[model samples]
Structure formats: structure tokens, C-alpha cells
Target: MRPTDIESLIGVGRPAISSDGAFAVFASSRPDLAADRTVGQLWRVDLAAGTPRRLTRGVHDRSPRLSPDDAVVAFLREDARGRAQIFVVDAGGGEPVQVTDQPGGVTDLAFSPEGGRLAFSARVPEPGRYGTVEGRDAAAEPPRRITGIRWHANGLGYLDRPAQLFVVDVPATDAEPFYPPAPALDEPRARVVAGPATQLTHGDADWSGVAWTADGAELLSVPDEIESRRRDLRDRVVAIAVDGGAQREVLGTTENLSIASVDVAPDGTVFALANDVGEGGVDFVAPGVALFAVEADGPRALTDAETIDLGEVGSHLTFDGDQVLVQDRARGRVRLLRVTRTGAVSEVLGGDLEVNGHAAAAGRVVASVASPESFGELVMVHGREMRALTSFGATARERGVVVPVEREVTGRDGYPVHGWVAVPEGEGPFPVVLQIHGGPYAAYGVHLFDETQVLVDAGYAVLYANPRGSAGYGRAHGRSIRGRMGTLDFADVMDFFDAVVADDPRLDGDRAGVMGGSYGGYLTAWIIAHDHRFAGAIVERGFLDPAAFPGSSDIGSFFGQEYVGTDPARIAAQSPMAVVDRVRTPTLVLHSERDLRCPLDQATRYYAALKSGGVEAEMLIFPGEDHELTRAGRPQHRVQRFDAVLEWWSRHLPVG
Candidate 1:
């Protein structure tokens, strides 16, 4: 596929299955060039016949949830004012009615077991402001107040408002509604209301992942500490009554485990994903599934074999009988697995395909799968057999996309390293680009990556590997480079690249370029500074100085202390800014203006240093964007980013 074809790709997410096993609903997005934006809509698929149809067409819609009785499908949609609110439609298809019109907008939502009430999380605005700045004159607006360490986030900017849980009653069919439904228009519409939402939690903590028990007595949620003392931020599972009672901690307090997501079974069995904390108050261990009896005893590790790290920390957990199903990232691919209450783990479906999102109900599992050749599609898994439910990426596949070849390389320390190489279509010896993934803790999967494909299509070979600090390679492998970020991980990357160049005859090692973002960006900057073998480098949203990061970044207070420790000398030695005078290669620095994780000051400091040393450097700052620029940025901006990278590489490394 061509670079411009990026706009045509359809993005699918968060599939939810009805309790009766009749149909499934999911959120999807496609380019709307006329509006200069991507439009998100809800779609449904019949499980038995494998037929799919669109349900709701809104400006932006997502997070679909099917009610218990399978009569209503509730979802979140952005209104004309760009505020997200809950909307519901009939299962058979009809006009959707807006349920809640909160000012701050809802972040996450879930339907109660009885379908009588909907529980959602919204940012609690200050008194009398109602979570909005609308209708107030600018001169009369109150001054902004800041009282917390995490006053801002990456994507959602300033955190003046704190997220809290709320409950709203679903309008009864025969009862008089607060807001009457609008006349059925040709296009989809929402019934705007004044007020019906009742606040439940009043604390300063951020509550997320709201799940209700089978009896609908209490709502289970994960509360994250966001105050100044964030180093003590261990997530706890809290139970809040549906009738506005006191909230109590359920688990993850005494053991000091960092709990993330939680799920409750019909029999009061609770399953959660938690990471063990070391004596230093850092979660250096890999996360795994933990089981809690709720009444008998506290949480216990279900999988302690050292091979299982619950793939996505925030992945949804579903209980089927006595087994809990979840998606896990193993090696480079994501697979669906079933973990029994007895701690026996088995893979239900395993392959090179990446499972983005999944939902299970009534003994059926549906997931959105993608690979190197295909962008994304919906598939239903039945034991070993699988059925395709949607053709989301047929056009891209038919047009012939590049597929990566997997290879294993030995690290300098004699450890196994997983890597992939995607060469251009016709090649003798091609200029190579070493791409690195973010999250020194995250791995590069065997999936359809837009950046990799674009690089290959631009007549360059792209190579990526899971270094020592990457996930899915077991706990020890992930934590090996925690305190020594640039020492061991850097060696593994350079060794892997050298091995790949030696094994492949079609790779031109002399004209190599390096690029990465986040943690990968840190490595790219480090590589060019230490070993000057590359002709060019692209550093995007990377951390440069561990000393400056502790005060500037959103997670600044604990990040340096947990990853690099408290030694001032060691922190300075590991920073790329310390060795800026050693960098001789031309570099392109890309950063988001509002990025809170690494912050824009990181790029500014690095760029100033590079220029002062007479190194060829350029910086591009994308406005109104955060750290997720490459993945979920605007369609126009994404295309522009790809074009800029291709142009920069072509000019610096001349492939002819």
C-alpha cells in the first residue's frame, strides 16, 4: 500500500459480546476527508451467521457495552461540542438516546448486571463549575489552581478536574423521562438532557475500570493515587456500594503489589493482574494474574512459573465458568489464553497474529486480529477453528503489503533475541533503518505497523528487535536493564543489528540510519552519541536527562528513582545530554508540544546542545498532540509525519 493509503485503513477496538451469545458490538473508525477528521462508529456482528452491520454513526463513538438482557447497547460518543457522553440504542437498531450530559465528559462506563443502572467515570469539576468552562466570560473566569504533582497528563492535558465514579438510572419505558427523545431524524441523534447523574465517590483518587458484580450490590474499581506522594502509588481494588454507601479496599494494600485491572465472577471470585514490588518500593517484577476469594483470604499468585506475564496490564478479564480468559503477548505475537482457578494456564489460540481487543461470553470468543500483511479484521475463535466476521483490511491486503521475516539473534551476553526484517520488494543491497519500539518495557510485535511498512515502501529495509528491557521475554529479561538502562540494553541492540547485517547479504551496513520514540528514542540518541556508525538519526519524544526529568515530567517524581535509582552521579552518567559533544550524525528531533510524559523541554534541551556542538539538527513540534502522535494522532498529521521521515531519510542516506 502507498503512503497516502494510510487514511483508508479502518481501526477497530474494544469488542463486547451480548450475554445471550447472539451478536457482538465493537467500535470502528474510518477517514472522513470532507470533515478533515476520522469518524468513529459502532458496528454489530451476528455470531451464528457471521454477518456484520453498522449500528451508530457519530462524529466519534467508542467503548461499546451490551446490556444484560441484550435489549440495549450503550456507548460513548463525542457531541458537537467535542464532549463525550453516554448514548444508548435498541439492539434491533433505532435512534440512539443520550443518557448523561455531564460537563467534564465520561472517560469509562459499564452496564449493571440487571441493566437498570449505568455506572460511569467522569472528571469531577469544581463546585458550581460543573466540569465545564462554557458560558463564562473570559475576563470573569477564575484563576487556575494547582495542588497535585500530576497536574497534567500526556493526551488529556491539565488535570484540574479529578476523575470520579457516578451512577445514573436508566430511564424506564413507561416513566416520564427527564429529557424527551428527539424526533427520529434521517441521521443519528442523541437526546440532550439537563441533569440526572448522581456523584458516587468523593475522594481525590482516580477511579477506573468500573465493573459490577452479578448481584449488582457493589461496583469494583481500581483506584490510582495521583497526589504529590505518587511514589507510594500502588493501585488498590476498591468496592463501592451502588446505593451510595462507604467505599472499602478489597485487595492490593498489605501485600504491596501494584494492582491494575480486576474482574468479578458470579460466585464472588475476584481475579486481578498485579505486579510484585521489591524492597525498594519499585514494581521491578513482571505483572501476572492474581486470584482472590473475596471472603476466604487475600490475593494469591495464580501463575508463578516465571513464564507468564499477563500481557497487557489493562487487558479486560472475563470469567467463563471457572476459567478466566485474557489476551497475552508472548514472544512477538499476542495470543488468547485461558487461566483456570487452579493456576493451570493453556493457550486457546496461538499464532503470529496480534490480538488487539477481545470479549468472551456464552462460551464464544471474538477478537480483532492483525498481522504484517493485513491491517485489522474481526475473527471468532472456536477451539482450533476460526471464522472471519469482518473484512476491514481486504483492500490493503489485495494491494500487496510487505511481510516481515522473523530471525533469531544471539545477544552479547549469550541470550536469545527476537527480531524481524522487512526488505523492499526488489533488492540487491538496500539501505537499512534500525527501528526501535518505545517502552524499554514494551516489545515489537508481528503486527501491521504503519511506520515499518512506510519505510519499506520507501525503498529501505527496516529491522526491529526485542532487546533486554523488552516485555514478553519473562521477568528477569524485562528487569535486567532497569537500573542500567543504557548499559545492557544498548549492547543487545547493537549486537543484534550487527548479527542481522552479517547473516543477510541484501543489507547495506554502511548506509544505516536509526530511529525510535520514547524509550526507543532514548536508545537512538544513546547509539549515535556512543557509536558513530549511522549516517542519520530520528529521535522522537525521548528522555535525555534523568536529573531534569524528576522535576519536569508528569511521572517525574518516581520515574528516575524507580528506573535509575537515587545516585546523582549515575543518573547524570546515563543521560544522553551528558555526551552531546560526541554526536556527529545529522539528527531530526520530533516532539509533541503538550507532551507531559517526557515534556517538550526534553527536546528543547537536546536540540540546543546538538546545535551548540555544530551538529546538523532539526526539530519539529506537533501542536495539540501528546506522546501518541504516531499511533493515534490526526489522519492528516499522521500522513505528514510519514512524509517527513521519508524525506529526511532519502536526503541523508541516498539509496541509489
Candidate 2:
């Protein structure tokens, strides 16, 4: 696919299945070339008939959720002022009604068990004279007092506001709609119809993944209690009563594991995806599905030591009767697996395609699936049968797409590395670009990646692999590079590249380039510093100095302690900046101005050092963007990023 094809690509998000498994609703985005932006809308699909239909047409809508009774679907949409407010529409089809009016936008939301209330998490401004100001005023007026270590996030920007849970009562009838009919066709039609929302949780800690109990009397959530200054604080599961009583911890105090997501079963069994702390460190712990009983001794891991790794990016867990339905990553594909209370794991639906998000009900699963040729579409799973619900990427597939061929390379340490190689249509000894994935813990699976496809379209062979530190292989494979970031993991990357080059004579080793973001960015920087086989390198939001990173990044204070250790000397040694003087490859650095994860300073420091050493280097900073620039950035910006990569590679690794 061409780089411009990004605008036409339809992207799908999380899906919500009705309680009776009759229908499902999900959020999807398609390019609006007229507006020079992508517009998000909610879509519904019938499970029995397998027909997809658009439900709501909004500028930006997401987080579609079905109420318990499946009468209405609640979703978040941006108002004219850009604040994300919760809106509800009939499950069958109708105009959406606004439910909340929070100054700050609502994020993760959930419906009450009885479908009478909606609980949502939103960022509320700090108590001050200028606190209530929102939209353009809040952006223009910014002279804030920084008080805490975790004050800024990569995409969301300054954490000056606190995220809290709010609940609003839904109306029993729609005789008088929350909003009146629009006078003009283009005017917004959402009006606040629900009662004034009551604040549920308070304080500086951020609460998310709100889930209601089976009885509809209480809510369970994972709250990051920032009691200490250390960035390595672990979040705990807490129960908040519907009556607004004091919240109580469902799990006992133990900082060993960092809880990611939480869900409560009908029998009061709490299930979570968590990373168990080991001697290696906390940040590198491979997340696994676990079950927690309020009366049992403690949480018991359900998928521990298994080959399947929980999809931590956007995966969720829910109870299907006594079985816990989980979406996880195996090899390069995200699949749905059923885990019983006795630790028995079995595949329900998934193979070849990547399941982005899913919701289960009445022994049926509705998920958004994507592949190497398709972007993302909705699918339904019942028993052993799976059927397509949407065909959004039919045009792209018809235009001829480059499908990656999977290859397994033996690492220097005797471990097998999984990767994909995608070649252009017509080529001979073509320039190759080695693409690395971020999260250091995440894997590049059998999914359609825009970045990889763009490179292939530009007449470049793209090679992406899951090295030693990547998940989906096993727990040991993921934790192999915990303390030794640049040692074994780096070796695995080089080994995989060497094996691919030796086997494929069409790939030009002399005209090779490397690029990656986040953890992948870190590896690209590290690879160039240690070895100069690559002619060009692109580092996007990478960490160079571990010592400085722990202080400047959002997860800085604790990430270093977990990955590199407490020793200052060892941390410095593992950083790419330590060996900058030995680097000779031309490099391009890209970073977002508002990126708090790796921060802008990390890029600036590396660029300055490269220039000082008389090395060819260029730095580009995206304004008002964050670490998720490539994945969820503005449409135009994403095109520009791909263009920049192609331009850089052409200039440095030109193929004549």
C-alpha cells in the first residue's frame, strides 16, 4: 500500500457484545479527505445475520459499550469544544443523547449491572481559579505549578488534572430527549439528558478499567496509588460500593506484581492480567492471566509458564460462565483463549488473524480482527465456527498488498527468533529496512502494519522480528534481556539479520537501513553504536542515557530500576550514549514535543552528542504529539512520518 493509502484505511477499535449475543457494536474510523482528518463512528453488526451497519455518525466517537439489557449503547464522543462526553443511542438505531458534561473528557467507562447508571473515569482540573477553564482557554493559559514526579504523560500531556470516577443515572424513558432537534442539519444534536454525575473516587491517584459486579451493587477498578515517590509503584484492585462508601482493597498489599486490568466474575472471583515480580525486575515481567478469590489465599496464575502471552496493549478479560475468556498473543497472532478456574487453557477462536478487541456473551464472541492484507474488521465467533461481520479493507486488498512471509531464525543463544520479511512486487538485491517493535516486551505479530507496508511499497524489503526480549515466545524469552538490554537482545537482532541476509540473496546487505520506535528505537540506536553494518538509522522516541531517562521520562524513576538495576555505573554502561563516540552511521532522530514517556530531552541530548562527534545526524520534532505518533497520531502527521522515513532511507541507502 502507498503512504497516501493511510487516509483511506479503516481502523477498528474495541467491540461490545450484547448480553444475548444477538448483536455487537464497535468503534471505527475512516478517512475524511474533505476535512483532512479521520472521523470515528460507531457501527453495529448482527451476530446471527452477520450484517454490519453504521450506528452513529460523529466527528470523533469511541469506547462503544452495551448496557446489561442491551437496550442502549453508550460511547464517548468529542463535542464541538473537543471535550469527550458520554453519549447513548438505542441498540436498534436512533439519535444519540449526551449523558455527562464533565469539563475534562471522559476516558474508560462502564455500565452499571442493572443498566440504570454509567460509571466513567475523567480528568478533573486541579482546584484553582483557572481550574474550570477548558478547551481553547485551557490550552492557551498554561503556567502551572509542578508538584509531583508523575506530572506528565506522553500522549495526554501534563498531568496537572487528576482522573476520577463519576456516575450518572440514566433516564428510564426517552419521551423528552436529552437534546432537542437541531435547527440546522450540520449542528450538533447531543444534549445532556442524564442526572448530574456524582464523583465516585477522589485524590491524586488515577483510576481506570471500571467494571461492575454481577449484583450491580459495587464496582471494581485498578487504581495506581501514588503514595511513594518511586515510579515503580504497583496498582491494586479496589472495590467501590454503589452507595459511595469508603473504597476497600480487594487484593492484599503486595508490591510484587503490577496489576494491569481487573474483572470480577459472577461468583465473586476477581480475574486480572498482571506481571509477577522476579529477581530480574518489574518492568520486564511478562504479563499473565491470573484469578483472585476474595476468600482464597491469594491470586493464582491461570496462564503462567504458558506459551500464550496476554495482549497487554488493548486486551480485556471477562467471565463466560465459569470460564474466563482472554485475548492473548501467540507467535505473531492475537487469539481468544478460554481459561478455566482450574488453570486449564484452550483456544476458543483465533489463528492467522490478529484479534484487536473482543467482548463475550452467551458463549458467543464478537471481535475486531486484522491480517497482513486487511486493516481491521469485525468478526463473530460461535462454537468452533468464525464468520466475518465487516469487510472494510476490501479495496486495499483488491489493490494488491504485500503479505509478509514468516521465518524462524536461530539466535546466537540457541533460542529461535520469529520474524516476517515482506518484499516488493518487482525487485533484485533491493534495499532492506530492519523494523523493530517497541515495548521491548511486545511482539510484532501476523498483523497488517501500516509502517511495514509503506516501506515495502517504497521498493524496500522490510524485516521485522521478535527478538529475545519480545513476548509471545514464552516467559523466559521475554525476560531474557531484563538487566542485559544491549547484550543478548542485541545479539539476537544481529543474528536474525545475518540469517535473513545469508538466506535471501535478493536482499542487499550493503544497502541496508534500520528503524524502530520506543524500545525498537532504543535497539536501533544501540545497534548502530555497536555495529555499523546499517547505512541509515531512524530512532523515534528512543532512550539513550538510562541515568537521565529514569528522571526525565514518565516511567523514568522506576523503569531504570527494573530494567537496568540500581547501580549507576551499570545503567550508564547499558545506555547507547555511552558508546556514541564509536558510532559512524548516519542517523535521524524523531521525537514528539509532548512525549513524556521518553521525553523530548532524550532526543535532544542524543542529537547534540552526534553533532559533537561530527556524525551525520538530523532531528525532527512533532508538535503537540506524543509517543503514539505512528499508531494514533493525526492522519497528516502519520503520512509525513512515513515520507520522512522513505526520504531518509533514499538519501542514505540509495539503490541505483
Candidate 3:
């Protein structure tokens, strides 16, 4: 897969099925190389017809949802100015009607059960800020008082503004749609879609994950409450009555475990995918998100602690009649699993594919699945069987994208390590790239990974492994490296890499290059510093200095303390920056200018250290990009980075 091939890559988001199980709607997107941005549209597939149909002409439509009556399709769309708002169209397909003209734009929206009202969430900036007439630009606004650490977030800069819940009544007739001018957001719960939508939430808090009860009498959402400022990813689910828009019932901490997402059954039973803490904070690795049923009686575990972890990344837990549906990750493949109140867990759809997401209604199910050779595609689930509902990635597959051949080897200890190698089409002696994944907790799974495919296309054998400290192998493996990032995890990585290189004659050990991002970037630096087997190394957005990382990164407070340690000596020992002088291999440091996850200082400091120490090194930074540069940054940036990487390798460790 060449860098430009990504322009044809397809991404299918989570599926939203209709109440009657007749059809499913999802947001399908792809990169527009000419525009340097992503273009998306809503699509619907009729179960009976077994075909997919385009439903919208939007350029960035997402979060496609069907009304309870299946007559309306609601989704979020970004306008010409890049501000998102809610839009609704007939299920049969027609011109969409804009429902909200929110200034900050809507982030999440859901249709009420009665189909007369829509509940959504949007950021509310101070009256004089965020493009308001009082202050067209943030620079012109009054000086803001800094108060909390969570005030800033990656991607969306300064998050001091509160995001509240709102309700808008859809026009009952086919009359012209009403879109009121946004009002000042000075008061709590002030509606951004003022005049048309009624405000439901207030205060300085942000509300998200909005859902409506079956009766449409109340709405449930997770609020970024006070405790969240001190506690990472902390949240409390609240139920608000729609009548008075005042009555609220707070569901406190779920048995001390933080909730990632929650879904309410028609009977008021709350099913959630929860984990240890910190929501998805980088440091909250190891423990898997378990399924829980929260009710008046108390919270009950519905997933087996010994072998269940419904990954919370996209696990939109939902009620499929008496059974609950979630995406569970085990042994690398993310499978859709169903659980009963009695703790009887069964796999609804399991295979070598990663079930990115799943949704079911009226006994019918649909999911977005990805394999080792595909990014994402839609599938219909029928009683443990899955059938292709879309051929989105057929082009890549037909182009002969190298599929990673899976392998497992025993580590230094008795632990068995798992990984994969995608060999380029060549004869013998292929230069190798050890691709490390970010998230000391994340694993290299049997999914189509762009990094592996891109490197392999350049005639380099890529070895990407999920050593210890990676997920999908269970919490034990993940927790092994907690507070010891460079210990067992590093050993496991080396052991697996060495084993694969020794067994595969196609791989050349001397010409090997180590490269990774985020945590992977850290490990790459760590590998080149401690072990001098590589001729070149590329560290992209690495977590270099732990002590300094606690404040600069968004998840600073909890990430470093939990993932590394409090001991100064241990932190120094594990940090690559602490031992930068030991590096011998020529290296390339790539970073994003606006990266809040790792920050640009990490790359700058490391590059300065390398140059000062007389090591052959270079640094490249992408403007206006964040930590997700490789995954979701601008298409142009991604292609440029790929080209830079290939050039770096060509100069240092050219393929034989």
C-alpha cells in the first residue's frame, strides 16, 4: 500500500439499527486528497434487500441515528465553517433539514423516543468568546481565569467552556425548519440553539453520552462533574426529567469503578462498560472494561472477571432484548459478545476479525468489522454467523496488501508472547522494521494496520508484536508493566523480535530499524539506547520524560504516576531522555506541533540532546496536527509523514 493509496481507504463507523430491524445506518468516510480533509456520508442498508444505499450528500456527516419510528434519520454534519450541528432527513432519502445553528456546534445528538424532540450536547463558550459578536476571536475576549487542569484538551483546544444538554422540538409539519441565532452562553444551560431548543443542563459542567428513556419522560447522560477535575475520567450518570427540566437523580460512582459508557433498558436497568479508573487515560492500561448491570438493588457483574474485558474504546453497550451486547477483545480479535443478567456470557460473533462496533434491534444485528487486511467494513450477524454487507476495502485487498502472518513465541520468562510479521514480496535478506504500537496497554492485533502495510510496501519486512503490557492477552499481561514501563515489557518486546528474526530467513537483523509512536515511540528510543542492534530508529510522538509529562499532556495527573512510578530513580531509569547519551544508532524524531498527548517539547528535547551528544539525528514536526496525526490527522500530513519515514529508512537502512 503506497502513501497515496490511503486516499482510497474506507472507514465505516458504528452501525445504528432501526427499531424494527428492517435496516441499519452508519457514517462512511474516506480521505479527500484534493481537499486535504475527510469526507463522510450517511448510508442505509435494507436487511431484506441485502444492499446498501447512500442517504445523504454530506461531506462530513457522522453519528447516523434512526428515529424510534424509523421515519427520520438524524446525524451530525459540519458546515462550510467546520462547525457541527444536527440535521434530519427522511428515511427514504431527501434533502436534509438543519435543526440547530449552534455556535460552538453540536457534538453528540440523539432523537427522543417520541420523535418530536432531539437531545444533543454542545460546548458553550463565554458570551464574549468563540466567535460571538462581543468577541469574534478568542484573542479579543476578556482575559480568562485559569482554574483547572482539565481546562485544555487535545484536538479541541481550551475546554474551559461547559458543554450542556439541550432539547429542540422538530417542526411537526413540512414547514420551513427553524434555526435560531445562537445566544450568549453566559448563564448555565443556556441553549446554543436558543429560541428553538430548550436548555436542560446548567452549571460549569460538561454533559455527554446523552440517551433517552423508553417512555421519553427523562434523559440520561454522563456529566463531567466536580470530582472529574481531581479524578481523571471520573463521571456520574444523571437522569433528568423532561417535564420540569429540573428534576435530576445522580447515580454516584459505580461501586467505585468509573463508567466509560452507559445504556438504559426499557425497564430502567443501566448496563455499562466500566473499568478500574481514569476512563481511558493512557495510564489506565491492563485492566479490561467489564460489563455491569447497575440498578436500585446495586451493581452486578455480568462479565466473567477471569476472561472477560469488553474493550471500552467503542463498546456501545446496548440492550438486545433480555441480553446485552458489547465488543469484547480476547487474544487480539475483538468479538461481539452477548451477556445475560445471570452472568452467562456468549460470543455473538467471533472470528479472526475485530468487531469495531455492534448494534442490534428487533432481533437483528449489524457490526463494523476489520481484519488483518482491511481497515473497516459492514457485516450482518445472524445467530453467530456473519455475512458481508459491504465491500468497502476490496480495492486494498485486490491490490495485494501484505497480510501479517501471526506468530507466538515464549518470552524470557515462561510467558508466551504473540505478534505478526508482514513480509514484503521479495527474494531474501529483507531489511526489517520493528513497529511498536502506542499505549503500553494497546496490542498489535490481527487487524489491518496502516503502519505495517506502508513499511512492508517499501520492501521492508515489518515485525509488530504485542509483548507484555499489551491488551487482548488479559489484564495480567497488561498490569505486568504498570509502574515498570521499561522492565518486563521491554524484555518481552526484544524476546519476541529476536525470536522472529532468528526463525525467518527473510529478515536481516543488521539492517533492522525500530520505529513507533506515543508509548511505542518511547520503547523505540529505549530499544536503541539500551540495545544497539538497529541501524536507524524513528521516534514519533514518544512519551520520553515521565516526570515532565505529568503537566504538559492532557492526561498528565494520573497517566505518568500510574504507568511509570513515583520513585525518582525508577522514573529516570525507565525514561529514554534520562539515558539519551547512550544512543548510537542514527535516529529521526517526528512530532506534531499541536500535540497535547505527548507535546512537541518531547521531540525537541530529545533531538537537542541527540545533537548535543554528537549523535546522527533529525527532527520533523507537522504543523496544526495533534497526537492522532498518523491515524486521523490531515490526509496530506499522513502521506507526507509516510514519505519522510521511507526517505529516512532509505538514507540509513536501505533495503538489500
Which candidate achieves the best lDDT against the true structure? Answer: 3
List the candidates' TM-scores in order.
0.94, 0.93, 0.94
Q: Which ten residues in a row have the lowest lDDT in candidate 3?
A: 186-195
Question: How would you encode candidate 1's per-residue C-alpha lDDT over 416-499 as one tens digit per residue?
Answer: 888899998775599999999888778898877778887887889989999888888877888788778899889888888999
Please tell me which predicted candidate would have the highest TM-score against the true structure.
Answer: 3
Candidate 3 regions off by >4 Å?
177-195, 226-233, 278-283
lDDT of 2 by residue, 508-561 (tens): 888899998998888898999889889989999997778787668888867777
Q: RMSD of candidate 2 to the true fold?
A: 3.4
Candidate 1 — number of clashing residue pairs?
A: 0
In model 2, the Cα lDDT at residue 112 comes to: 84
